[model samples]
Target: MRNQGSLRSTLHQRGMRMTPQRQLVLDAVRELGHATPEQVCKRVQGTAATVNITTVYRSLDLLEQLGLVRHTHLGHGAPTYSADEHEHVHLVCHHCGAIDEVPCELLDGLADLLAEQRGFALDASHLGLSGTCRNCRENPTAV
Candidate 1:
């Protein structure tokens, strides 16, 4: 979860008008943790009861552009969003379609190696490593 107080100040510093709709959308995203725009819309409507899907999408786009939100394509579905705090990557389960966070530092050596050898500075933060989770590995047919 994000610090609401700091988020508000960040929005103000970014010159964004802190409207009730935007606030509601931000609250929904924060509360939902990793949520899609549709999920955010549903959450916002739970309280505001008047916000539309378009408003949620616009809010998400603006928030992402302002570096307040980060969206990741976990698997084959819509991208999931979370508060943008630091560099991180997603560990996606291929069988069960689960997503987990892995610190970007874990791949720092690989990033450096790629840069040195292939001249590619990999952006691990925006990448998802797909593999089988422990549970899925143990029960291969469960999926």
Candidate 2:
């Protein structure tokens, strides 16, 4: 979780004031690890029933703009948000719909290859690789 003092300072630096709603939204994102905006709104509403989804969306956008959080598309669904410092590659299982995280270093070779061949800098942490997980691969019928 980011320091509350720093969060306030960062918002102040951007000429924005930190409200309780924004703080709750940020807290929800850090606590949930990765969540959609609706999930974030639900978590925030748990603490403050008056907080709404629109507030959560605006807060997420502001937090992302400040580099305090980042979003990644896990599948065809809504994007999931996570703290900016939470750096890792996401492994999404297609059959079971399971999500796992691996160190970003695991993609070093791919990143290098992309950079060399296509001049494309890969943001490994911002990417999700979809495939069958070990469990699903081992037990195809289980899915």
Steric overlap count per candidate = 0, 0
Instruction: Write one digit per residue (lDDT tens) for candidate 2, span 56-80.
Output: 9999999999999999999999999
lDDT, candidate 1, 1-143, per-residue tens: 45667667878897866778877877777777788889999999988888999999898988888777878887778787877764588898888888788898899999999999999989787788999899999988888
| Candidate 1 off by > 4 Å | 1-15
Query: How well does candidate 2 match the true structure in TM-score terms?
Result: 0.97
Consecutive 10-residue window with the lowest summed lDDT within model 1:
1-10
Model 1, position 116: C-alpha lDDT score: 98
Question: What value of lDDT does candidate 1 attain over all alpha carbons?
Answer: 0.82
Model 2 weakest lDDT span, ten residues long: 1-10
Residue 91 in model 2: lDDT: 97
User: What C-alpha RMSD separates each model from the true structure?
Assistant: 2.2, 0.9
Candidate 2's displacement at residue 98, Å, is 0.7
